[model samples]
Target: MPTGVALREVRAQLFGAADRVLRRDGPSGLTSRAVTAEAGCAKGVLHRHFADFDAFLAEFVLDRVERMDEQAATLRESAGTGTVADNLTDALIAVFGSVAVAIVALVTFRDELRARLRETWPAGVPVLTEAVVMIKDYLDAERGLNRVSGDPEGLAPTLIGSAHLLFADRTGTPPDRAAVHAMVTTVLGGQA
Candidate 1:
């Protein structure tokens, strides 16, 4: 909007605006105009950076997925350091307490967006699938270190699914940390 000043981190700013739009208005409310308005820029700001709206969306989802990779690495490193349930509890909070839930809903509601994502993400929802991978990999690491038992591959989906249900359908504010911890502890079946 400034006459001469250039915007730094334009992609981040747009992506963040889109995410807020998605969260406040859901998938239907996420549009180029909405995103641009939220970013305090002109509509061309989005098209200028992306081939189309779907392109911007795909990049937005991918950017969040990349964040999950970092979270996965940090989680794997925490293996054997804390109680298994506690670590999982924290990780679940990190995953859902962010924008993963909203992103999942967006992917579910948009057909073209889902199709566009399938080029790289062939199966499962984008943000949710990536979160599942993050949890599963960390669980496998914990299992390797003898910090956890049973099938992590099986447990990971259940944890993600259950947590998804818990985190989804909220009015305002995320589920309490104690509630998430309780769910994790329950899913672990005394493994914690």
Candidate 2:
């Protein structure tokens, strides 16, 4: 019988292979044979470690989400007393950078993975909704402080959609941090 250490080693190898396949070939390349080839292991090793591709994909996406959420939480905590733009920008950069691979995974499996995501990705909606609320709160607070002028409630969704589309774009160049800030700031001004 395989020892616990041996089992962990095998699972680690499989996850590494899966990660590489996801990165280099997108989500469609995650077949059992593909993973095994990447790992330089017997083809059956993948099935031994995971029930199937769906299970592996679900786990991998969930892992990425959890890691991203943790990073976002850290950024939110450390943003200090910076302007709303500064804090929000730092938090978004952390969240987006970590979840770039997961975003690609979602794009690759757009239709097939939605149900699994609904089940496993509970934080998805809440985090987004909270971000919008935070944007509004920042606007209100900053307006009170005279740092910004406008209704955040009206502008929050536009900013959210801008960031959403920025990452969703498969074009060779996605908007950089400055671009997003400029776009969001413009949206903020338009609400005035």
Best by lDDT: 1
Q: Which stretches of candidate 1 lie over 4 Å from their true place?
A: 1-5
Model 2 root mean square deviation, Cα atoms: 5.0
What is the lDDT for 166 in model 1?
88
Clashes in predicted model 2: 0
For each candidate in the order shown, give its overall lDDT on alpha carbons.
0.87, 0.59
Which 10-residue window of candidate 1 scores lowest in summed lDDT?
1-10
Clash totals in order: 0, 0
Cα lDDT tens digits, model 2, 169-188, are 43346568897666665666
Predicted structure 1, TM vs. truth: 0.94
* Per-residue lDDT of candidate 1, residues 69-181 (tens digit): 87888888989897988889899988888888888888888898899999988999988888888888988988898877978888899999999998998456688889998
TM-score of each: 0.94, 0.65
